[model samples]
Target chain A: MNAEDRADHFIGRLDAAAAAVEQKLDALLAPSTLKGEIERPARLLEAIRYATLGGGKRLRPFLVIESAALFGLSGEGPLRAGCALEMVHCYSLVHDDLPAMDDDDLRRGRPTAHKAFDEATAILAGDALLTYAFDVLADPATHPDAAVRANLVLALARAAGLGGMVGGQALDLAAESAQKPLNQQEILTLQAMKTGALLRFAVDAGAILGAADQRQAATLTRYGAALGAAFQVADDILDAEGDAAALGKRAGKDAERGKATLVGLLGLEAAKARRDALVEEAIAALEETGLGDATATLAEAARFVALRNS
Target chain B: MNAEDRADHFIGRLDAAAAAVEQKLDALLAPSTLKGEIERPARLLEAIRYATLGGGKRLRPFLVIESAALFGLSGEGPLRAGCALEMVHCYSLVHDDLPAMDDDDLRRGRPTAHKAFDEATAILAGDALLTYAFDVLADPATHPDAAVRANLVLALARAAGLGGMVGGQALDLAAESAQKPLNQQEILTLQAMKTGALLRFAVDAGAILGAADQRQAATLTRYGAALGAAFQVADDILDAEGDAAALGKRAGKDAERGKATLVGLLGLEAAKARRDALVEEAIAALEETGLGDATATLAEAARFVALRNS
Candidate 1:
């Protein structure tokens, strides 16, 4: 199929994947009723449910499901892994929206967690979601093998922890008030950690689940790395040019805060060129995986990253 | 030995345990130096170290080490597990002391995390510590067995997640603006969840590590539950009667905030009576373990819970 038709076909599959994730998340985060003498508080679950349900592209889970598909491992395992990853993503957004952090009033075109609920509830909700993600991954339901479960737990923890997302966030905040502006290499490192680490984990999680051999896993890892960097560049492009209503968050934030971004350092055209090159590299990395057409949609995903408006 | 002397003996061990935990934590959370192009931020590590390194009684780790001692597993495994649990505890404290939560200015007789660092840094530090805890636990270094590592991650996640500590924190927040005051049973459930879950896990973790049989594990679980309840009651008593200088935090916070506390439900004397009963129950449960002399220090630990000044 041609690229446009391929992209269109993948978008349909993406919507289906997103719907499946929402259903899975709904069942996973169902409201609690006080059973027996023990009273399970409904408020925390309510906050978690609110933050997770009915939003986002569900791209991380889609990547997980798709990558696992490359190795012929589909069904509940990849989907559940996706849910856990989404929980981590949503939790980051919820905590990042707190008054003490980004202080954004809106996310996914709705009130942010701290805005929808009180700051205390929002903080607790984020903590619960993060803890729950690990719980979900460690459960026998996620993977039957104990080793796989342990590996998933370790991978997710490392990706989301100090050396990864949280550390990157610290760097991002430090950059804001920094006396010296972060140069290109520093900004690249910051973005890779804050945004790319979890994406890398999402793809790596599939390989771990599918039990890919070292070389196969390495190929997918490179693809994920390239895709992640491309995704960030596209995001920078969107921030520079997209509308707030379309984006569901404020646009021009990087420029407004003087936050160092690729688009800010390089002009829009040069940034677009960079994104296109990364997408090409991501697609090329998939060629060595020997999955043939099974990787076509992943290449489509890379293209989608380069061109998505929001 | 007399109960007083036994308690004193256990107190000395607790002090040693705390010292050991501090030393391990220093090694675990040491400042990072980058080997490659990537630079792990020093500021984030600084915040984590500042919040964790030199503070508190390290009571939770004491519980883990003491309980693990029951099973004759007193090498680096239990000590590392204790450090992980303490990291989770310290993270919770850091987040709980945020301006949006308790708004506490002092913790362990020093500036709270948010006060010492910016709010964003404190939040990131807490997130980092929580993430690092699981990373430490999942590492094979924590245990030789993969199954054991997975179980530790699972148990810690459950205790700290929506159904446990964070859930209780949410309930506590809901109670603040709640139209109706929580009744005795409701307050009991909340306290068990918020404060008791981690303590229960500390004991349970040791049982899991020592590979106790079902009956032995259950015995330790019961001991943990009773000890946890007693610990909360003692904390309430301290909040009501202890001096701020001694407590290292604002005294009478429950009364000032109109928080639902056991001491509020029962009068101070009655609360102390309840704490003593729980302590007896805790000691009684230890008797079933049949460790005999090996469990004396644990029994002494129960008494220490009832009478700790801070």
Candidate 2:
């Protein structure tokens, strides 16, 4: 298929995979009422559902399924892994929007979880969703391989915890009061940890579930890491130059907060060039994996990240 | 042996188990230096260590190891499970002391995590610990059975997340505004979800690891549930009547916040009586488990929960 046609095909598959995951997520999150002694509290569940089920690109879940498909593993494990990645992403977003953090009232063109619910509820919801991610992986009905499931759980935890997303957040917090602006390397490191870790995890989870050989897994990890960096660079550009309506979040807010960004460290043009180089590197890394369809779709997706205004 | 002698023996075993688990936790949480690109953020790890170690009674870990002993399953899995439970417990304590929540300054006779670190750092530390709990359980190095490990993960997640501890916190938040005092049943239900869920999970995890029969698991679960309630009742009494120095936290703080406690709802005498009854029930349930030594130690430990000052 032509590049455009291929992109369309993958997007369709991504959408379908995301829909299936949404259904599973809903069922997984439904409160158990088997024992009537304890009534399941609806408010916390409601808050979690509101935060997670709200509209977004579902990019992490898409990456999981796409990467799995590349590895020829389209089984229940990969799908559940996809859903777990999305849950982690959603949890991060919810907490990031809390009054104590980014404090954004709007996300994905709707009220943020903390704004829609109270701050306390939002915090609990994020905690619930995060814990629920592990629960999804642990469910015997879904992920059968305990070793693989445990690996996925570990990957998610490391990516989302102190050494990954939380570390990025800490750096961001520290940078807020810095006398000098963060350099390019610092910004890149922060973004890699903050945003790139989970993205890499999404791809790695798929490869692990697909039982890819160590070499194949390494290639895919490299591909994911590069793609994640490219995606973050694109995000920095979008935050600086894109319209708020298109982004579905407040544009230029990063600059307003003096948060470190690739676009701030490098000029917008340099950032764009860097994004292109990273995307090219990502595609080249994928070539080693010998997965023609995933390589093509992932390459197109990388290009799309560079070009997209939002 | 007399009850006192039996209690001493049980405490010794529990302390040894906790010490072993503590060493493992220290090793697991130690900072690893990433070469070249990624710098390990020492502060975040420091906060995590501060929050996790040198605090609390290690009661949850005691439950895990004690229950594991019931099924004659020893070694890494049980020790790891013990560490995981302690992580969850520590995370809860860290978050519970936040200014937006319990607003306490002291925990285990030390400044709360938020007080020792910044509020945001404390929040992230709790988040990190909670996520790390799943990581420990899911670690392939420790757990041989993926399915069983998954079960443990699910149990911990449900107990620590919204359906359990977080749910209980929400109820406590709402109860703060309630004009009427909570009844005995309400208090028990709240405590069950808040405190009992993890306690039950600890016992159940041991049963799962030991490959206990369904009957034994159920009996152990019952024992844990009653023990959890008794433990909470004892906490209430300590909050009401114990010395701050003895309790290792501010005494009577629960009453000061106008939060309902077993001691507040029932008078001190009635609360003490209920604690005794619950402890007796816990011991009776353990008698049904048919594991002689572990059950005996557990039964004595149940009584110690009511008798110990800290």
Candidate 3:
């Protein structure tokens, strides 16, 4: 198939997968017992729902499913993994927007959680969602194998916790200390931990779900790592070039804040070239696994990451 | 054996268990690969370590091990579970003391996390510790069963998240707006979710590690629920009457804020009576299980909760 036709087909599948994940999330979050008159905490629930449902490219979840598919496991387990990753992602964004953090007022074209509600509620909401993500994975109905579920939990915690996301955040804060100008390597390291780590987790988690052999899992890990870097590079490009309305967030804010970005460090053209190269490397890694049928859509998805408008 | 002698023996065992859990935590948080050249985020790590090692009664971790003993599963699994529960407890305490949360200046005779560091670092430290708790459980070496690990993750998440601790905090916040004093039911509900839920999870998670029958597990659950409530009641009593220096925190602060407490609603004498009754109930539940040897220390621990000064 031609690239455009292939891209269209991949997008359709991605949409279907995302819809399924949303449904599963609702079921997972629903109260188990309704026997008594349990008053729902409406505001907290609203914050969680708002943060989660706010529009963003469901790239992390998509990578999870696609990676699992490459390993010949396409079913409920992979879907649950996707949902869990998205929940963590949503939680991070909520906290990132808090007054004590990035303090952004807008996210995904809507007021941030703290802006919508109050700061305290937003903080609690993020904590609630983060805790709930693990609860979903632990649910008896979702993950049946104790060992695999534990692995997923551990993988997620490491990725999202201080050694991963929080660690990257701390570095980001330190790097932005008044007048410091971060080098390309430092910026790459920061982004790799901040964004790339979880994205890598999403793909690696899928391979774990498939219970792929060691060699096969390693290939998918490389694919995920490369794809994650590509995804961040593309994000940097969009922030520099895209319109705020189209991106659903304040564009060029990164540049204005003097935050480290691929575009800022590599220049726009070099950043674009790097994104392309990373996508190509990602597809090559997927090809090495020899699961051509399952990975065809994944290859196209990688290309779309480089080519998409927002 | 007399209560004092039994209590002493139990305390010693609990201390040993906590030390073991702390060692495991250190190992888990240590740098995984030297090639990464990533120094631990020292300040954040210091905050996490300080919060965790401040040395309260270690009640939650003790309950985890004691419950596992009831099912005859005494090994590294139970120890790991104990550590996981402690991590969650410590994380909650850190967040609870944030400027936007409780705004407390002291915890366990030391400065609260936010007071010791900056607000943002403390917040991230709590988040990191919480996520790390699940990581400990999901570690392949500790919990080989994916399904059981998932269940543990769910239990911890539900107990600690919005539906549990954070939810309780919201209720407490909203209760401030209510004109009428909170009733016994409302106070109990808040206490159950805020404190009892996690204590119960600690006990129940330990049970899940063993090969207990449904009947036996149910018996342990009943014991844990009653014990959890009794423990909270003691906390209420201490908050009402204990010395600040002895308790390692400000005493009577609950009453000063006009916050709802079992002691405030029931009066001091009645609260003490209820605590005794709950401890008796906890012991009775243990008796019903007919598993005395492994559960003896747990029963004694319940009574100790009622009588301890802080």
Docking quality of model 2: it rates as medium
Report per-candidate DockQ: 0.64, 0.59, 0.56
Candidate 1 vs 3: which has more lDDT? 1
Candidate 3, which segments miss by more than 4 Å at Cα?
A: A31-38, B31-37, B144-147
Q: Pick the candidate with the highest lDDT.
A: 1
For A23-104, candidate 1 gives per-residue lDDT tens digits of 9999888753212235556766788899999988999999999999888899999999999999999989998888777789
lDDT of 1 by residue, B82-146 (tens): 99999999999999999888898899999998999888889888888888888888888888887
Model number with the top TM-score: 1
Q: Model 1: runs farther than 4 Å from truth?
A: A32-37, B33-37
When sorted by DockQ, best at the front, the candidate numbers are 1, 2, 3
> What's the candidate order when arranged by decreasing TM-score?
1, 2, 3
Lowest-scoring 10 consecutive residues by lDDT in candidate 1 chain B?
B30-39
Tell me each candidate's TM-score.
Answer: 0.97, 0.95, 0.94
TM-score of chain A of 1: 0.97
Greater-TM-score candidate between 1 and 3:
1
**Candidate 2 local lDDT, B1-310, one digit each (tens):** 9867888888897788778877878887877622225775667778999988765567787788888888778888888888998998888888778877778898888889889888777877888888888878887755677777777888898788776888888878778877987887888888998888888898998898888999999999999999889989998998888898988887888899899798888799999999999999998898887776657878877988877797
Q: What local lDDT does model 3 show for residue B259?
A: 88
Candidate 1 has an lDDT of 0.88
